[model samples]
Target: MRTIALHTQTSEQIGLVLENNDVIEYVSTRPEVRTLSGSIYLGKVSHINKAIQAAFIDIGEERTGFLKKESVPWAQTSIEGTLKEGQSITVQVTKEPSGTKGAQLSADITVPGFFVIYQPYGKRTAVSKRVDAEQAEELKTWTSQQLGKDEGVIVRTAASKVSTQTILNEINQLRDLWTRHIKANTTDRSHKLFDDPILPDQLIRKHPLPLIKEIVVNNSKLGQWIKQRYPILAEKVKWVKSVSTYTGISINELQSKLIQPVVVTEQGMELVIERTEAMTVIDINSHKFKQKSLSSYQKLEMNKAAAAEVAKQIQLRNISGIIFVDFISMQEKKQEKDLQKYMSGLVRKDPVSTTILGITRLGLMEITRHRRFSNVSEELSAKQKPTFSKDTLIYRLERYLTENTQSEAVLVAISSDLYNHKKQLLSNSISSKIPQELFVRHDASIIDWQIELEGSLDMIQTVISERVYHVDNLF
Candidate 1:
């Protein structure tokens, strides 16, 4: 089953692509950490370093954006001579900010639509390589005819599946969008020109619509909006109160254990993954298998399963840069060659440019995935720790209390520390959204929040009154 599960709760939104019950790509986005990959900015050159031949740009973001010399398409001679400090420049974000680095800037701007990407700085037409050679040639000929002397349009893979007129219309639409929304902003002040971070649009840009069998979302508001906005996908959109309801998998568990060093696949194969500062390393082990000894074919199958799992994990964790994977040792060169070929083919499915550098003499499979954004470990590791702040506890408690809308009234017993924190914060904002007949019992000895009762208002109140009496009594 090919499914896109969207979990929107609290401040973060998570999107997971599941193929046959396995997660291949896991994307997490928050308002504060939103990606700027396709954003265009009207920036000013803050400073220029002659030694590094790079310029620091004020893109009206938290960090100073970095623009290298090569990224400046119109640059000539030296960086100091070509660009002046405080000069206004137009640039596109090629990569999102990772770690302490700012968004990667490029002078070459490209605006993408459903079927075509309009490039104003180009002169040649390009077709996606995934298209058949004959079809690609035809698309190239037809698309090139539509381009101007200085403009270009890349015929995306979706264009091959669509009509020539549809592609042309999209090209025009994208060009007009750029001209009106981005290019028209000729103000000298540093500001963002264009940024489209819609969740449905973001998913469509990453995964082809035809390949998506179903899209399950947790938020009812988002689910309804998607169906209303795009009636074409109304059938494919499924809304559930809980994200894990249809998948039979815990979204919270998947997220909590995502950064773990060990993972076990359904085939009884254990994968030990170590991510260091330099590279990520993975080892496949069959210690958990039931069979005491396996045949050569069985061993190969294990290795194959491991290879596929490694690819899935790589994308899910967003592991990038240098990677080394070690499968079970094989004696035959043919098996090794076959494994390499199979693994290479699997990695090709990744949206990011991931290359299989082939097997090393030490029996390590070498691969490199281009680093665009921070890995899941970098963002999730800290959050996964047991030590959560009082604010986090409040959020968790609130999520737990109101998860079941069927409950008419609910009462929860919470620790004094948590109750104090919630009271200290916006108490009205926190309490106004919950059930009308809700009661909170603050116990000094309690370390966790426990749901006391979920029933009619009279029943819940009686239960809380009894609890208060028992607490007051020494017995």
Candidate 2:
């Protein structure tokens, strides 16, 4: 059975996890403002670097969005002074901000709908490759007849099973939205004209609702919104408490284990995933599996199992960009070829575009995945070793208490030495937020920056120290 769990209890942002039977297949979270993709902006060109043939556009955000000259539809023509520093243009964010680099933008924007994607300036109509060849040709013919010469549409896989009226209805809605955006862009004020929905709504629009066996949302407000907005899915809507018992691993277990770098399989094979500034490296080790007396076939089977887990972890962690995987070496060329093919097929299932570069001379597999947003591991790593000031700590403590309304009083356990250092800051915040009762359970075993909160912190709390130690040793 297919199950989707919407986790909003962690913070204000929402997270979605797709599971098949009892195993996690996909995981994603709503991005913050700095990393927002698919947002349409009316931006002013800031600087043009002729050497690189790229321009930086000021989208009224913290960082400028980078627009390549080739990506600009008008830049291809012989129009002099077409893109000036002060010129305003409509662009969509194709990539999120990574490190110090800005967001990637494209002038050719396409608005995606449930059944089709409307390309305002596109030349020809097309169908999704997932559709069969016979139906795809028919869809192309139908699109040519139905659409105007100036219009273009890309029929989605969902359109193959949907009615013509449904496709037309979606096309009309998208056209109206585009028209409104164009009208708004003509005004003097520059702003964000459009943005894709949050994680939950995006999933609903991207996938057929009928295919999902159940939708469980942890936040009551989000669940109510889903029920009211899409009454057709109301029957499948369930509260967080009602569905907590269904997951193979409890939410807390998933959160705790997510921060770890190593995954041990049933046969004791280990897959170590490490993310660095330049690239991600995955190492497969069979030290424990070798203890058992097994033939070469059994070793290959273990390697295949490790390959599947690596693919799952890549998607689960949202690791993007260059990836190098070192698998257990096989002496036979036929076995090596089979392992390479198996790994390629597993990665093809990723939602983000991924390219497998095949096995290198050293037997390492190279891969490249389009970065969408900061992966779950990256997000957690950012907060793992943060240095907070007095005011920041107070603010965070207040925010945490306010967000978790279910907890009347929280027992905070921390190192005595660290507690003494921030005693004033903690007391001040506790006095304001927790008027009823405040308990401080100090233990020397707790390290600096380590915090333990008991009662109703299932989603917000993360065992950072435990995972950090494992990562430190692994690296």
Candidate 3:
């Protein structure tokens, strides 16, 4: 069974997709680095690069959006012929802004519903290939009749469970959503038209119902909203005061593991995953395999086991674009073929478009995964590893004082920003974390923060009383 866990933390909202109690995917959203994917915009054509066959558009975002000539579904000519410098057009964001680059936009607009994706400029109606062959053909014919020649609908796997009436209802709702945003011959300035940023609902829509044990969220309002929108989920949607308390999963521990580059498998193999601007690299080392010696077949088995871990890491990290994996070298061509087939089968399980380009001449496995959002590392600021806030430090200090130094209290020297807070606010805020008996003394002498002294409460007080004018006792 699968469970979805949602939590709001210090700087971001986190979502976890757990399969059989293991975290399969980790996603987060931050206010500063928001995603632009699936957002529609009234954009103005800023520049058309005929050489590159692309257009730069001003969509009222921090950076301009890039729309390739091929992305314009309705266009029959070159980008220069199709777009003018001052022309206004409706576009949808297909990718987020990376580094200094702008977001990737597309003219082919698609609005997604639970069971169908409404394509306003799509050429033909279609259904997921995972659907039964006969049913896919039937849905294709039926949906083609429902949608006109210009528009189309891509039926999803979930559509098989619902009645035709429910599918049509979803189709109409998605169509209405597009029709409401797009209008005929309006000269509107460059600005945002619509933002489909409800990630929890989007995730729930993507996963089928039979696999889900329950969708637990910390926020009651969000749980209620999910229940309302997806009545099909029935009692599967639940509201809880604390997700970890109910699910027995520590989100913080999972998040911490996400930031680390090294992953050690139970097979004693380690995967060192590194992300670069150009691509991601995964180097697998089997120096410490539990088996002392391996036969050719045992080597093949090790590579296959590593392949499963690689696939899980790819999804969990949300690593996209080009990826190269350097696995333990296999000497036999037959063994290499077996490993390739095994990895291909594993990548097919990913929801996103992931393809194995087969093994290169250097025995490196080449892979490509395309996605629209920032990766787990980027969202977590794993590279930066910023210092903790004052509140976080206080919480840590309280834990330390309670756990290890129960009889002893410490004198801390913190920066003025932390030490010189408003009088009443400091007492109320800092005092609430520790017991009234445990004491804290602060001074603005140090550059950042440091623990000055630790002793029994009375000894610390005696020292402070000797140097009475030097420090301020916060509690």
Q: Indicate the TM-score of model 3.
A: 0.72
> What lDDT does model 3 reach?
0.79
For residue 456, give model 2's deviation from the true position in Å: 56
- Give candidate 2 regions above 4 Å deviation: 9-12, 21-33, 45-56, 74-76, 79-88, 98-102, 181-186, 201-211, 218-250, 291-293, 382-475
Using TM-score, give the best candidate's number: 3
Report lDDT (Cα) of residue 475, candidate 1. 5
Q: Write the per-residue lDDT of candidate 2 for residues 1-475, one digit (tens) a residue.
A: 3567776666535345565654443355544444357778888888888777888988877789999877776576422345888888888888877788888999877787767888776657999888999999998888767776667788888788877877787777777778875535554455787776546666565455446678877678988887764555678878866345655446556666778899897767788888778999999988875566877787678889988888888887778999999988777778877887898899776656788887888988888998655577766544455577655654665566556665544545555555555665555445455532334555667564333444543322333333332111000
Q: Estimate each model's TM-score.
A: 0.71, 0.70, 0.72
Error of 2 at 169 (Å): 2.4
Cα lDDT, model 2, residue 101: 87
Give the better candidate number (1 or 2) by lDDT: 1
Winner by TM-score between candidate 2 and candidate 1:
1
lDDT, candidate 3, 109-152, per-residue tens: 88877788889889788899889999999888888888867897
Q: Please provide, for model 1 over 284-399, each residue's C-alpha lDDT reduced to its tens digit, 9 standing for 90 to 100.
A: 87776645677678777889889988998898899999999988877777888889999999988887779999888888899999875568877778644357778887788777
